[model samples]
Target: MSRYLFALGQLVARRRWWVLAVWIVLLVGAICFAAGTGGKTNDNFTVPGTESQDAVSLLQQRMPTFSGAQMQVVFATPGLAKVTDQQVRAEIEQTMAGLQGLPQVAQVVDPFQAQAVSPDQRVALGTVQFSVSAGEVDADTLDGVDRIAGPAREAGLEVQFSGAVYPGFTADIPHTPEILGIVAAFVILLITFGAVVAAGLPIVTALVGVGIGLTGILGVAAFVDVPSAATSLALMLGLSCGIDYALFILSRHRHNIVLGMPAAESIPLAVGTAGSSVVFAAVTVIIALCGLTVAGIPFLTVMGLTAAGAVLVAMLVALTLLPALLGFAGDTVAKFISPPLHPGKAEEVARIAAYEPERTCGHAWGRFVTRFRIPLLVLGIAILAVVAIPATRMDLGLPSGATQAESSTARKAYDLVSRSFGPGFNGPLLVVTDLSHATGADAAQTLMGRLRQESNVAAVQPGGSGNGMLLIQVFPKTGPNDSATTDLVNRLRDDRDRIESGTGATYLVGGTTAANIDTSNRLAAALPVFLAVVVGLALLLLTIAFRTVLVPLSSIVGFMLSVFAALGAQVAVFQWGWGASLFHVAKAQTLSFLPIITLAIIFGLSSDYQIFVVSRIKEEHTRTADAIASVQNGVAHSARVVTAAALIMFGVFVAFTAVDNPIVKPLAFTLAVGVLFDAFIVRLTLVPAVMALIGNRMWYHPRWFARYIPDLDIEGAELERRFAHDAEVEVPQGITGVS
Candidate 1:
């Protein structure tokens, strides 16, 4: 470790151009690399082989051998007078004729056909099935939808179109993450250091890091199934956190320079202290996120690993690229157009004499903590407890099209189909069974009868896989989140043993509901593993940094309490009707993946802030040899800066909720509340109070561990001595404000 530090010192002292050139070349190459890669399929939020997918595949396979059409288009209004009238039919026919002429379109089922409408004839619906193979959905298939939809809207009728195509293609997935990432990087740096050049440096370094990372991820995609579109979000987050850590170190380096240290000496001095914190914080976040691999869901597992990979790249970039940039920029990096706010001579005098016995610990930290400790601790706990209240009532479920904005064509189409045909019109069920024996038919018939008796079931019919398969159409009573889906799944599972025993066959239930329920169950089962990883990783890193057994444990407890509080608050907003209209989501909307997503995102973010605070406190404690004094000084110094950073971060996250997509809203909501709680409550208040109470005893470590660990000089003692020796030179007359 010391050798690496010394090597870094040499690199700075020698002013190596190769390091800067290499970074520039790699960054430029990465840009070309990304541009070279062509567009790839997006599978981030897709489940490939569920029953609906299989049904579509089977239809495509049979399309070449068989008949007219399989999908439908419906026209709806207050009434059907204009739709059923002759002029309307002529216009509709003209549109249908245009569609029929297309090479890929097989046939257009006329809505005016008597068989299409129900008894009252309030709705006139059309059916369109393409001549193309059922096995694939390509441009030709989507073009057919657009061809008819475009003309129908011009005919002045209320028309909504729903099929498997729109749900798979046209849902509004927001693109806010990119803007959020750019803005977040700027905000964190500006707030942390208060210098424009200092703020801009992190953004530049992080972009290079993320650019390299994206190139690597694109390469990895050839060997694995990566979630295509949303990978950008992970890359963005890694860049933001990574850059923040680097700036933390660089700002400290600039502070040393301002105090008269030579540039070369300040580099190692900063690296040994803040650079070390950056590495540990990055690693801890990586570990927490990567813990999602235990869940065994390929989508989540891929996301976790990819996100972790990006953070690792960010760390390396910050350490290498940032140092070189700082070495190149020198004192000019801290030169702002506006002058720094200079503290009065009395404050300077007090700071210069701060090390004296009369003032050092007794006067500085002792006076401060005695005056303010209880109030700080009380405010923190109160905020955490209050904000976290909503998490307790959290309801978890899959996202649905009905939750989309009414203006979206997909949502409008879904509503029409659901009202005109059946509630589960968009998604139906498929039951697969082994049917090699006589009992197979009997068991299948019995299951069919039970399904027919269900109130929410619209119909049951034979489907693909020959004798073993049955397609059951369920009219979901309460839409996606209704208790009916969960109830039906449980009932089927309860009856599975008897049916399987009698038929000597295995039965599997596969559908939208079943797929959602299975995913929920898997996540629930994996929660313990995820929590264990988060807590275990925090303990490992904190122990290494603090060297105390109980301090890490206490920190974990405090963090867990904060997490519970955040989750509880989420529950109240989503499950209860606290802020429904304000957030623009359904009062009862629940995201099925909330727990796992929150675990990965919130845990990492919270831990990031926690490490920043604790690192400063630990630094102060080492300097003063007094626990309470260290806690007071560290909190006072860190609180304002961290709070501002957190506020900026919170704004970036909260902005995403305004987008018109269901998936993005939950992510934004959880992240925003979590950041606020972590910034103001958990990090600012609870952590400081606990450190104050624990005091000097927090550094206690086993003698066995201490012996193996070499001492790291983060105090800048050598550089300070060198600068003091060089201070005999006269100050420049132009710089009139010298103390």
Candidate 2:
């Protein structure tokens, strides 16, 4: 793999202009294709094979009107007032009249007639049934509902629309988050490289790669059922990995230039070594992402595969485009605001661009850490364990209106309903029963009686009946994300066989609330299987890549610490509401996919940091034959670049915490902190301490395993071997060069 990369890098250097042109043309074509035939993204929440899905299918077949996108147009006033008063009722009825006339509105039920008014009569909830799903509702149609409600607003009633229809969903997601993240990344890169050209090159390459990937996603979304969130995930991963991958390789090439290696030699050497690590790291990430399918969840499968595709593109860009760009950059990437690294010294160039170590700050830290290896190891584990304690109480469930931003319209409606009706009014479970063999009234009464016996049941009322199918609506005493509601759902299902056997009726517990419960239960059941497939598979792959058992074992342990630490932070902040006021966020159930997604991505990053740092140390250990010097020299050389890349990735992810989207905020926070702990504490601190304890035995591998484990040659050993015999020369210690 390294030899192929070396040859590819040399080829790119020889054809730099052609390579640049091809990338430019490809990028342009992608832009044009997306603009010409771009498609909108829709969020698909349906979990196949669940009771909720079966109920929806039943509704679509028998009771079509009630099956479509349903929401409440809530009108609220102070407790002293009643919306049913003559004047308020008149205005609200007029507004409903206008809503009925709007496009895609199938029907509008009047609050007074439906008896949907609250006990205090201060809040009135009217139903608006749409002809199509929420995703198909035009933005103009949703806006028209708001626009036509002027009469109700004028009558002193606070009118609000509910459901996904209110958001007026659009494909034009705001670019502010991406722009902010990129700005932060550029600042960190400038500090790391200390040159405008050097810093800007990584940023440019990252933007180019992300631009192409994003456009391709948009273009393909026209023909594919791509979810809106998938694009965000793709953009985030693509940009973060692209910048870090390019930065690592460029950092290597910059040092080579400083040592007076020619551009031709330095470029290939950088690609052969650093680029190989990038590929291995990306493969691990892609594998973990693809493993999401093992959960047997469709939407999650889409998200994982989509994110993995972006990571793959970023890796390829770093390997191919970055090298070609470096060929043109030469010393310009390393020589700005200071003397150039190489001052035109081609006369006495050495054939083998050997590994040179300097006594830098990383070297000093490595020596100190290894000397106190036991204490450092204990301290790192103690910090992680302490942080992970919060994860024990973490709540994992779907987001509810109660967890929405306080100022959001969804929260307003939820609060108004809860204040007037009850908290459970925001989440009502629907029971759909088949009354084919028995009388409709008898079957409906029997099912409602069974539901009424449930401990958490607040109210059980007939929803509607049509075509031998009866709908029963049951409201819980607790909120949608409450554990009590989950228990009620389980109890209902447990009694399903007894209830149906006695009445000749078949039923399904469904609706948004019940569906969320079912989805959560499914995810809980699958989490273990997901971890086994993704983590177990990643371990085996790492074993093959490194040809060592202890290293991969250490990596998995570090991975757990990083991911759990991040989840603990999320639980404390988002779930426990600790420091919530700072972000203007509310306490709620953490996003259900947060842990799963975080684990998969972090597993990849852990592998990346482990391989990049350890492989360098292993290279020096092989060359020097002294474990202590190998640790010191390798740390001196690789630590700076590793630290810089970690920080850049951290900056990119951290910037998304400020986004208004609730789903993105927790995930961004998790990834940001996960990267920080994994890179700084796990990679830099724990890894070296363990290696110190193991001594030279850290590199040991059984002969049987060694024969099967193909050498990736990520250390550039093959490149050096080929060059050394051709023309080896010793580089004097004091030799220096400048552009």
Candidate 3:
């Protein structure tokens, strides 16, 4: 792997202009193709094989009119004695008239006819129904609806929209988060690299990679139902991972340059060594992402694959495009646009000081940790354990309107509907009962009476009955994402057998609220399977790389601590509402899939830290045969790049929280906190402390065991063996060796 990467890097550097042109053309072509034929992203939030989906399917087959997507158009004003002003009523009636003219409209239910006007006369709910599925409803239909609402808005009434078909956010990439993240990356990189071009190169390569990845997803959206969150996740992972990969290689190249190696020579050498580690890191992430299929959710599967594709592109950019750009810069890759901090020192000395951290802070910290290894290890564990306490009481659910920005229409509409009708009105349940075999004169009505008697049931209305199937709309007293609602759903299902025995009829609970319940249950069940399959397999794979049992075991332990700590932080801040105002979370609950996704993503990234840090120690230990000193030297060798990469990734993830997106915000926050704990505390503090305590026993892979596990040459040990005699250029043999 190292030899091939070395040759490939040399080829790319030699043909720098061609390599640059190819990437430019690919990015431009993707953008052009997406512009002409891109597909719109829509959320088809359903879990296949769930009872709720089955009920929906049965409804579509039997009752086509009501089964189609329905939009709730809310009209509100300051409390009025008349309930609704005559002019406001006139405006709403006009909008309904315009909606009737749309060719696809099946029916428009009038608010006055349905008596949907609140008792206060300040709020009204009207439904615009269509025959197509929510995912099939085009933007043209939505736009037409929005346009008709203009008159109502102009009539001193607030008009807001919320329903299955309405988009939660615009298609435009979240500019605030992405832009802020890039700016933060520039600052971090500038400080880390101490050179303008060096910092900019990573940002440039990362954007190109992310641009192509996102465009590809956009183009694929033309064919499939891509959730808007997929693009945001891809952007977050692609940009951060891209920069880190490039940083790893660039850091290596600078080290070589200061050590007397020519720029051209160092470029390939960097790729052969650091690029191998990048490939390892990227492959792990892709595998973990692809593992989302275990949950059997279509939207999440799309998200995982899209994110994996983006990561693959980022790795390729770091291996190929970054080297080409470095070739173009020539010796200037070693020069700083800003003056060196230690003026009057030799340029090499300043350059070395800027790029090679093992000499100063890295070594000093290494010594302190190793000297107090036991106490530091215990302290790290204690801190993470305390932070993880909130995770035990976590509450997971789908993001609701409450999770939205308070200023958004969806949020406003949600608030108005809850205040006017009831909190349960936002999440009404559709009960489908096959009452053909009714034992009594009115078994369906008897069942409805039973539902109304339940303490949680707020209202039970007739929802149309036909073909021996009775539909009942049951409204719970609690909000959609409330724990009380979840309990009520379970209680309702539990009483199904008893009701059927008395009525001689079968029934199911279905609707958006019910579907959310089913999805969360399904995700929770699959989480264990995912952990056993994906996490177990990942640990086994890491074992092959480390070629030891204890190192991999230690890594997994640290990963678990980091993940739980991060989750605990999320539960405290989001669920417990501790500092929730800072993030603008209108609701205090985490998303259902967030825990599993965080574990998968953080596990993959955790391996990167383990391999990068431990591989250096392994190399040093092999060369010097002194375990204690090797721990210090290895940490000193890799700490600078590891710290910079981790910080860059942490900042990028946090930047995504700047957007008002409900899905992206919490997901990014979890990832950012996970990275912070994993990188800074687990990898840097605990891993080293553990390694110092373990000593030589840490490298206990038997020679016989080495035969079964392939040596990936991730540290470029083979390259070192082959290039050891290159005295003129002072080629560093071991990737673990300090320049």
Candidate 4:
């Protein structure tokens, strides 16, 4: 592995311009191809083989008019008893006619014709049907509807649109968050390196890598059904990982140069050493992300693949592009853009001191922790447990319109409809029945009566029938995200035998709400499997790399603790409504996919830090044959790099919270918190303390098994072996061997 990395680095460094030019060409071509394709991304969460999906399929097949892309244009005339005035009625009718005339409109149901006007007469809903599915509707059709609603708005009436596709139409890729994240990362790097040129290298490398990855993702969308949120997720992961990967290699190169190695020797040495860890870390992340396929969710599968591709690209760029750039810059790269503080010039001098591989904050802190290992370990565990308590009450569901920004047209429409009609109006359930074997009309009538009589049922209306199936719309009294609605769905499905007794009819309760419930349930069932697979794979990889049992076990356990703590924080803010307003959350419900997705990403990222830190400790142990000194020195050596990397990632993740999209915001917050907890509490505190207490046992492994497992040497022990003999020959004048 070291040889290969060394060869690759030397090749890129020698052909730096050619390498850089090739990347530029690929990036440009990718951008052009993506723009030309201009493919659409959808957030459809249909779970194949689920009852809700089956119902949707049946409806689309048999009752096409009722099943196609549907949106509601809500109208409210405040201060008027009802919208019954002749002029208002004429205007609404004309608007309906105009909507129906659009080429995309399959049909438009007028409020007057459908008798959908509220009993109070202050509000009315006009349903528009599009020829394609909600996700398939083009922007032009949505724009046409918006234009048709203009006259009503101008006539002193409130008009708003709300539907599955309505939010998508208004959603914008949040550029503000990405920009702020990059800026924050730059500031962090500047502080860490104390030089503009040194700081900019990581940021520049990361942006280039993420740019290519995101563009490639767009091309992938042209052929596959990628979720709209996938790009944002890719960006978040790509930027952080790209910067961190480059930072690791760049830092190592600088340290080597400070030790008197020339640019030619230092570049390959840095690449061969830190680059191996980057590869290992990247592979772990890719494995954990790709494991999403076991969940059997199409969106998750595609999302995972997209994110993995981005991480892979970032790793490649860090290994190739960063080295080439370093080579091109040569000795000038070591010079700080900002001059270092004068010697003995107060605390600032301590902060801006030149790189010293022998001494680090970690070394001092490791010794302190070792002296009070038990107390520190206990304290760390207690803190994590306290923070993780909120996870116990997590309630997962898709964000409904109520959670949308109040200023959004969709939210305004939802509020108006809920106030005038009912919360149930926002998400009506479609109960479809195959009545071929029963007295069709009578069975339908019986089912409708039964549904209307149920306590939770707000309204039961005939939803048209075709062929051998009967469709009935059942509106629950509660909103879609309400627990009562989920209960109603479960009750209807579970009690089908009692409800349809002697009717010989099959009933399926489905809608946007039911689909959400199904998706949540399916993911919940798959969670255990997903966790087991991810953990098993990570344990195997760690065991092979470290040649130890307790080390891998400890790493996995620490990862879980960090994940739980992060989740608890998320649930407290988003679900419990604590600090919800701070994050712009209008309502408190955990996004259904948040926990699972965060867990996968956090696990992978946490493993990266774990491997880098532990690999260093193991290397020190092997070289010195002193467990205690090795643990302390190793941590001291790796602490600064790990903390800086963590801060960079934390900033990127936090910036994503600025995005208005509910789905992206909570995910970002959780990931940010997870990184912080893992870095400071788990890796920096708990890990070293626990390893100190365990001493040599931390590296214990069965001799037979150790022989079978290949040494990963992620810290580049092999590279050091090849280069140690050349150190004296390569050392510049005035630089002597250590001590």
Candidate 5:
């Protein structure tokens, strides 16, 4: 496999010019098409395949008019006084009238009307009910809200509209991930490679890979419901790593060329070494992403499959298209681009950096590592341990649609209603009485009475006269995370038999909390599957790379620990209120998909760093019998590259946390922190420490396994044989190159 990769690298280098042209054209065309043709979907709650979703579906059938719409508007004066202005009333009436006339709107209540406002009159609230549509009513709702908001806000009144339209905010999120990711990738590359063209390689390669992935996803969404917005984040992340991985190898190859090696010899040498590492990294990522399949949320399942597909595509692009571009661009990429960035000695610097240093006093960096390896390791481990402590407090919950748009009109109105009425107004429980046995009001009343007695229940309204169901309002004593929410759910299920015994009907409980409970249950059931797939795949890759069982097994253990630490930090920030006030955010009802999504992302990215580091160490071990020397050489070589790359990747990932929406914020933030830990702690310190302990035993393969497996040229002697005798061995001087 390594020989074939090297040969492919050589072949591409020979015909680099044409391949580069083709890649550029294909990428440009794909980007243009994706801008218009690529479709989008939401990434929120999924049907749990539980009784809750079933109940919701059944209720929808019985009550076809049930539109998942809730709207709220608050009228607050500077002094919290009532608005008695006739103009305000007139404008409010006009907005309500406009909203009522919207195509799917079932009803719109005016706050000035008798039942809509509270008795005290300090606050006014309105509700807009919708008729269930065949598809999401986002477009119509957003349009109507915009029209209403325009005139409503123009009236010198503060009005907010939130509801179904809130999902549209996510619609634009997917479009700019690649763009944001590209900008981030470039800035990081500049810092790492210290050359503009060198930095451009990763950005360009990522653009090409992501463009193709986008087109592929657009093709797939036609057949399934791919409404998860996190797909954008996943794709961008995949592209960035994919292209950057190639950049790592290609940059190394260019260094060989500057050393006066022939293009044919240099390309293969680069591939025989770094290409093997890239493959290992790619496989680990694919395995980790596949882990999401165990999650079972259709949203998460699709994310798993699609994200894996994207990573696979990126790998192929990196191996083929990227090398071709690098080969064609040749010394010019590093040469012309490196000049202005570094004075006049760019080539000299590249040469000197490429020449593997033996042992040196070096500088402050070396002094610190040599003098304080133990203390630095201890300090790093302690910080990770502290962060991991928060995982004990982590609580997973699906984010409700109401929270999607914090500033949406409907959410604002809902908040107003909740503040003035009760917490139950923000989230209501749906009670479904089995119509087969009891079709009368008496059974409904009995169910309602039972629900009201539960601790979380603030009020139990017998399904209003229209829906012929029971509607219960649950007001948590403290907040959404209050034990009352969970207790209410348990109480309803616990009383199921008694509620139905005499009445001949069972009640199904469905609400935000109920849905959340179902989602949590589904994830728990699927977690084993996710872990099995991820670990199994990662082990397979490790076995293939090191030809040993222990190599992959150890890697998996370390990967899991790093991921747990990342999740723990997320719990502290989102669930524990560490950074909530920074952005005017509230403590989440529970940890959102951030942790799960972070798990998948961190798994893939961390695996990328691990592969690079381990592959380098393995390469060194094959060349020299001294295991300690191999460890020192590999760490010295790959640590800077991994750290610099991680810092750049961290910048991109961290930007997501700054988004206004709460869902992606934590997911992105956790991604940044997780990747940072993976690169610095796991890849650099923990991996080296463990490998040092294992020594040459880390590379031991059972004799029988070796006989069955075909040999690959990635074994160090092959690379040395190919490039060691090449006459172009003049090492350059000046700035150190990426190799």
Candidate 6:
């Protein structure tokens, strides 16, 4: 693989301009294709085998009118004591008529006709049923709704839209986060390299790669159900990994140039070594992400594949395009970028030139940590434990409208409905009953009576029967995001025996709230399986790569700690509402997808640093035959690059929080925090400390397993050997080139 990568780098270098032009053409074509396709993203998260899905399927088949996209048009006259005024009613009626006249609107139910006025009568609720699913609703249909609501707004009445279609109307894939993240990455790169041109290369390469990947997603969305959230995630991963991969190779190439190796030699050498690590790291991430399919959820599968595609693009760009760009720059780049700082400069250059591990700050820290290995390990574990405490109480559920931004019209509608009608008015549970039998009507009536008797049931209304099936709208006392609502969903499903025996009817509880509950429960149930697959696969890969048992075991343990700490931080900020004001989030509830998504991405990303750092340690140990020295030198050699990469990823991920979407915010923040802990604490501190304590045992493996396991050569030991041999044979004695 290294030889092939080296040859590819050489080819790109020789044909730098052509290679660069090809990338440009590909990027521009992708952009044009994406724009031409212009497909909508669906945010629907449905599990096929779930009860909620089954109920939804039945509802669609039986009651087509009610099954379509439903929207609530909230009207309020804040100054008015009640909405009973004839003039106000007339204006609202006109609005309702206009809504009914819209081409996409299948039906509109006026509050006055339905007599669904609020208790205070200051608020009125009108229902609009669309002819298509919420995900299928076009922008023009939403615009038409807005146009119709203009009259009510002009009449001194507040009009707000709420429901599934609201997200569709407001959904957007913005470049602000990606642009900001790139800007932040550039600054970090500038600091790491201390050269403008050096820093710019990684940023430019990453942007190009990420641009292609993101545009590719748009193209993919034209045919498949790619959720809007998937694009954001892809963008986030693409930028971070793109920059990190390019930086890894660029850093190594620069080190070689500083050692006086020719650009041609250094470029391929860097590609063979650093580029190999990037490939291995990226594969681990891809494998981990692909493992999400084990959960058997379409949304997660799409998300994982989308992100993995982006990472793959980034890795390829690093190996191919970046090297070509580097080749084009050549000695000119060497002339501009500054050399390493003093304090045994020659020794440092020599070590880097030969790919020998050095004793830098990471080394010093490793030695210091070794002296107090037990204490450092304990402290590290304790800190993680402290942050992870909140994870135990983490609530796994999608955010309700209540958590929407205060400025959002949907939020105002949610608040208004909660204050007037009831909290449950925001998410009414649909008690769908299969009534193919002649006795179904009698069963429905008996079930309605029983539902009305329940203390938690706020109201029960017959939701009109059709096609031999009856639907009952049951409103609970709690809001959709409330635990009480989930409990109610479970309660209704569990009481199937009683309900079915008494009424001779089978009931399925489903609604926006119920769907969320079901989705969350399903994901929660699949979490263990997903974790096992991801962790187990990663362990196998790491063991194969490093040829060790303890190292992979320690790596997995550290990865979990970082993940737990990240989740804990998310729980603290989002779920516990601690410092929520900073993020402009008012409510305290974790999105159900946050943990699952975070674990998959973060675990994969963390492995990159772990493999790079550990691979260096193993290389040093092979050379020195001293575990302690290997630990110090290995950490010292790789720490700067690892830390720089982490900071770049951290900046990119943190910038994602700047996006307006609430779902993207927590995910970005969690990833940003996770990268920080994984880089600074786990990879840098705890890992080294633990390895130091373990000593040679860090490389321990079963004797039988050793014969079967092959060395991955992720560090490109063969490439290093070839480079050394070629240099010794080809270079003149007087030349001060890389040895």
Clashes of each: 14, 2, 2, 1, 25, 0
> 1-739 in candidate 4: lDDT tens per residue?
7678988999999999999998899899889988988866777667898888888888788777666666888888868536778878777888888889876677788889877788888888887777667767777877787788788779888888887766344487658887888898888776666556678899999999999999989887777788888998999999999999998998788766655578999899889989988998999999888989888989989989999999999999999999999998786655654345442232232223233334445677778878898999899999999999999998888877787777888789889889977998888887888888885558778878888887799888775676888878788999888899999999999888888986777889887789889988888888889899988998898887788888888899899999999999999988888888787787568888777898789988998899888888888988987788887888877887888899999999998888877778888999999999998889888888888889988887777987799876778888887777553533233332221
**Can you list the residue pairs that collide in candidate 2?**
340-739, 343-738
Q: What TM-scores do the predictions have?
A: 0.82, 0.93, 0.93, 0.95, 0.88, 0.93
Angstrom error of the Cα, residue 66, model 6: value is 2.7
State the displacement of the C-alpha of residue 203, model 5, in Å, after optimal TM-score superposition: 1.3
Model 2 gets an lDDT of: 0.81
Q: Against the hidden true structure, what lDDT does model 6 obtain?
A: 0.81
What lDDT does the true structure give each of the candidates? 0.62, 0.81, 0.83, 0.83, 0.65, 0.81
Tens-digit lDDT track for model 5 on 548-567?
78767767777787878888
TM-score of 4: 0.95
Per-residue lDDT of 1-739 in model 2, one digit per residue for the tens? 8888888888888898998998899889989988988665766577888989889988888887777676778998755778878888888889888989988887788888677788888889887778676667777888898798876787688997665456443335578889998998888877666677778888888888898888888787777667777788888899999998898888878767756678888898889878888888899989988887777777788788888888888888888888888888777865644435743232112111223344355777788878998999999999988888899997789877787667777888888888877878788888887888774547667778877887888888776677888878788988888899888888788889876766888888988888888777778788888888876877788887778888888998999999999999889999998898876778989888888898899999888888888888888888887787777777766777788889888888877777766777788888998999999899998988888888888888889988999888777777766654345445566544321
TM-score of candidate 3 relative to the true fold: 0.93
| Model 3, residue 452: C-alpha shift (Å) | 2.2
Among these predictions, the greatest TM-score belongs to 4
> Where does candidate 5 stray beyond 4 Å?
15-18, 21-38, 67-97, 107-116, 133-135, 149-157, 164-171, 174-184, 336-348, 359-378, 400-411, 439-441, 462-481, 579-585, 708-717, 726-739
- Tens-digit lDDT track for model 1 on 356-408? 31233323443455456687677767767777666656666766557666676
Ten contiguous residues with the weakest lDDT in model 2: 346-355
Reference-based lDDT, residue 358, model 6 = 36
TM-score of 2: 0.93
